[model samples]
Target: MAAKMKGAQILVECLKREGVEVAFGIPGGANLPTFDALYNSPIKVILTAHEQGAAHMADGYARATGKVGVCLATSGPGATNLVTGIATAFMDSIPVVAITGQVRTSVIGNDAFQEADTIGITRPITKHSYLVKDVRDMARVVREAFYIASTGRPGPVLIDLPVDSTVAETEFIYPEQINIRGYRIQASPLIDRAAIHRAAEAIAQSKQPIIYAGAGVIHGTAFAELLELAHKTHIPVTTSLLGLGGFPETDSLSLGMLGMHGFEYTNYAVAQCDLLIGIGARFDDRVTGKPDEFARRAKKIHVDVDPSSINKTVVVDYPIIGDVKQVLQELNRIVQAPDTRAWLATIQKMRQEYPLLYREKEKLLPQFIIQEISELTKGNAVVATGVGQHQMWTAQFYQFNRPRSMITSGGLGTMGFGLPAAIGAQFGRPDAVVWDIDGDGSFQMTTQELATASKHKLPIKVAIMNNQHHGMVRQWQDLFYQGRHAQSEINPVDFVRLAEAYGCVGIRVEKKDDVRPAIERAMAITDRPTVMDFVVEETEDCWPMIAPGKPHDQMLGTYETLKQAGGVPQHRRSDPDEEAKLSLG
Candidate 1:
């Protein structure tokens, strides 16, 4: 006789079989059966204050662990809340499994209380989705969800379970593996050998060559392979926002980040290079700036698991439809060693000439403040950011040495992401330092999370970059709309005082020198969460910007913009311990 199992029990068993150790969600009536199933499960269930928080937490976890981050939610609002998070994970190609409850099967189309067609709502964002109409299919669907989520070009997948279905009885037999006929994740070994040889020849013959990398490296777990390739070829590398930590920022060849807010030298090098090798990066309008003018001087070699991404925006001379790690390994084996000293030297000179700079004035800029905090944290802390100028600044400045060290609402560009995400990151890693880097306008979106943090006694540090406006939108208005900063201004709040109301510590930094000291003090005080407010430069903008639809080479170089501002820090000062002067090549 076979043992009986509830739908939820079978779901848990399936997740366990898939090796999932954590599930993030908020409990509700529609999900009660599933929550009951989780009561005694080995997989840890982290309760987030909001469903959105649960989704982002799962996203951060996936990014850090290279596993499928799982999020659970009830019907209606709970399900809807996961949209932004799902979209974020999708845009970044992070693996996620979002499980949502639906109304009873009888009431699904009738629009019963708290009912929403989560599958339909999420169809556009998720890689795939399913609504389990049968209890017997639960285990198989769960298994397939994991397979789809973790396979090639990983992304978010959804499984919608109705409340009644969760209470239904079924035999619990977890499948050991999944075999989908139409889903083929593995790249074929029989790629165009001639094209590969041509790519190798181009690299060998080029006097200047660079690799433009994207989030694909992180998704494929190919960072080590990428490093090996870059080191072997002696090619300088630049990354997209999602591609942070794809290469070590501390490495000599790493050109920080590239795109709308990229390193000036990185953009210039792409423009000046004879050969441009793109690895897993999409030629996004922000990254490419002027697509027609991007890398105009260079011959392009594009390697990606998704063939559609090749030559979609920017034309490529050579295309390889293979996995990044596999393609790089093959290229390394086939390519002859070339004399790239001149190219490497040119990059080194550019790095020295136009390094990332945030000037050290009496008052510290938000970028400088975040970099200092990141440095002090030693890449061990998990930093979350709200979407805006500060988010871009954090991506540009923070030298993340570890995976999942930095979490922001990258895809959806959602405001109010930091506080809740920090809450999630802290819950996910209790011993790890967690900082919520937020802006005044964005912080208000989820300020209620401070109450949750206080209730849980989670010691999260909230850094408010108070610029008195919606900085990014304001930046756009300033650039294109003749400085019409309509509806962007927000009344400043005494963040320190606000934290007191939430039973947390709050410190205000009015001066530049006070930024680091405030952070140190907050780090020292471990009793409760703390909020620090910094008054940053109101007019400071992220440099090396690639105006929309522009090519990679047409980027706003630091010399023409950032250096001209005279506020960026130099990176090559004699005193390695202090802020370097900002320079323009």
Candidate 2:
């Protein structure tokens, strides 16, 4: 049945059909008609203070709920403001759809107010983009946008609607099927059985095998399959930063995280493994210190849906291009547990030798704060973080037992992502506890979103590690730049009062003893948002860092710590050849 309606009305109706229960955005002259249509619709609209915050909120919602998140904005400045957030989602492969309202079609090129090339600006960051000049094309574009955003290698999609199109009248008929030429989602069942068998054979032959999983494991919903494959094969597991919760960190085989700042023993295990099974993980530079030196002794097997990712960095012996879950399912059926007794013993020894530890001081520490949160929440809360020292600390200390429990800007390392992401996570899982463990420098970037959280009464607890400096930047300068403290030092702001101004509860803790009580009080507030300022040591650095371009085994902080603790192994003090021999055996 066809009925006459404005394009704005059709847009709202199409969103309803796509199961969009909530949208985040702001209104302007170009988007007023869409806002007017939303006024009468059943969908909940959250008015964000800025367009960037709205985009991040949508990203957070999608990551938390595994749904295609939606955000709207006007064409010019509004569309431009979403660039950083869109890039964040694209780098991390989060499914989000951003809609922007443009000027009238006739005035699009006339330099009219609030007119920008929305499609041109967003093409690089989005999976697909559309511009709707005709009112009748609204339904099809919306359908395609959602489809593209949520499909294979999920990323963001953009839809640009002109003001004239929104006001124009047309008979609406939403498409029941999508028929985009040259666009195909790889079927999960069409896996190569021969390749799976070959991978299984390789697994059987290897003495020390490591499973390096990534966000794709979570995105493909292969958590159970990954666990089964690991358990069946008795392989130790390490993950990229975004892949933290793909395998339970509390498991015996779990190696926390493996990267530049990963656990010292995880990197050592990766260095000495005979076989590397990469599941949905790209060999990012952070994870693979020097690509040529990464897993030099290991035969690599990479499994991913995107074919281009295979051998894009480190060459692989066996590349299986299929869904992670499907490939793992088939592999689990044929795989047998390898004799990794010696390998597990070696890894356990390394773990015991170089554990994650920080100096106990009278002043508060970020690591202690994160440990408290993880203990209080039983490692079940949806933990979000901004990029910095705090982000790495959360990845290291927090025990994530489930997927989608850790949300952050991994690929882009975008600052100011924590608070808005927490807001979105709270909305997606209303009954669950959400925490934003943020740094002072990163939190100040998008701290205005506290208003949105307060207005909605989202019980998202924010723990600010107020170190009064750009912690990571300071660390780098200290290590690489002769301790010249540049503009990294941040002026102190009263975060407690700031939280109060936003209509939320605020608490500040200055001593180590107050950390647990502050967290407990924040946890007690179940109505509105609560911000806690824990003034931590200003000069602490994230340890066990592998300098850029260095091999994974050549970690800096661990050797010093181990030497100080009188636990430095005889092999660690030897040359690379001796270390490899000891680690390999």
Candidate 3:
């Protein structure tokens, strides 16, 4: 018997068929029917304080679970609120399905209230988007949205469902399969023996070779193969910002993050390497620095699922289009370890000579405080960071040992992402200790989320790296703009007092030695949320920066003039000779 159902009911059914167990969002007038339909379904709905928070939560969920994160919101303000989160997910290539309720189809073009053009607004950000005008097409549209979001270079997809359409009766027949004539996800077959042979040969011949992994490593679940490859080849590994947690940063072979704000040794190794094997990573601007000059000396073999990414910006010697897990497994079977002892020795020397420096002074520096907290927490706590200096420092210093241990807005780098995201992360892992590493500048942007955490009784430890200025922007000004600090300072508030007002346990730390005691005390008290305001040095900057539009190896900060000058490596700086070796183009 053919049964009739509301478009909203069909949407839920389609989602369920796609194995979506939970959706995060907030309800408003235009999206009432979708909320009503969710009441009877098995799919769980998590209500967030703001739509933007809900979208980010979904983005985080998708990043964590490797499934398409779904978020729902009403039209206009609600939909618009999800824009930042949506754009962030898009920039990161995270799989997310953003469903926004719209005004009635009849009034869509009539200047109605809460009637924003979500499709038009979100087109550039989302992988694809749709406007559901006909109720009968609801099931089909939803299925397509989920498919598109999960496949290829994954990203967010927006579906604007009109309120009137949600209630309209439609035949509910979930399609058994999806067929689109124009849409195709291209991937190479694993049976290509020649390509595999060449990749293996590339591995065996190079002396100074490293494996660079990205967020795609996590998405493709290639961590095991990556680890195996690293072990088999005895190669040092470095990751991009999104690539954190894909490998245990504490591992001896792990070089940590490599970028403008990455470790001194990591960026140096990228510059000096003769060969670079990038798995599940796009050579993005942040990672590559200058497209023409990035990895100039290294012969690169890029293994990614997306073909379009191959040699798009940076030149790739070998581009393998397949899932990273599959390609790495194949390469592992064919490749033998190159004698990298000399190479490893060089890297070790570089690491030992120019270690990540956090200056020790009478007053506290944020890095020292974060490192102390990390040590105190024993790497068990989940660190969530807002954008800028605090985020880079946390990524640099914190030894993330497990998957999803570090959550930050890496791709879009949305400031004020700390408090609400920390709350959402706490919910995701209720048993794990959660810490919000925020800068005072970024923290003030979403300080209101303190209320959300306190209201829900989420035991999130917020450690404000309370530098009274926007540290990252200030660093740029100091280095490139001749120290003319503009609009970076803010009248700092008493974060402890603010936390206290929100019914949270608060502590203030101004001295270097007080950091550990404060964190230990906060960790001991788990009954409510805790905030530790750490008054830190304001002028400190993230070093090893490859000046904007320069090569990845061309760092603006300290670099050795000679190969062993001060026992430091030469590739750490953006010398023209180093650029001549790496063939990015």
Number of the top-ranking candidate, with TM-score as the measure: 2
Tell me model 3's lDDT, rounded to 2 decimals: 0.82
RMSD vs true structure, all candidates: 3.4, 4.3, 5.3
- Give a tens-digit lDDT track for model 1, residues 230-338: 8787777887777777887766667777778877777778888888888988887777777878888989999888877888998999998888888877787787655
Backbone collision count in every prediction? 21, 0, 7
RMSD of 2: 4.3
For all predicted structures, in order, the TM-scores are: 0.92, 0.96, 0.91
Q: Which stretches of candidate 1 lie over 4 Å from their true place?
A: 187-195, 357-363, 551-557, 560-569, 572-585
Put down candidate 2 lDDT per residue, 160-184, tens digits, no spaces: 9999999999998989999999787
Q: Which of the two candidates, 1 or 3, achieves a greater TM-score against the reference?
A: 1
Candidate 3 residue 152 C-alpha distance from true site, Å: 2.9
Error of 1 at 377 (Å): 2.1
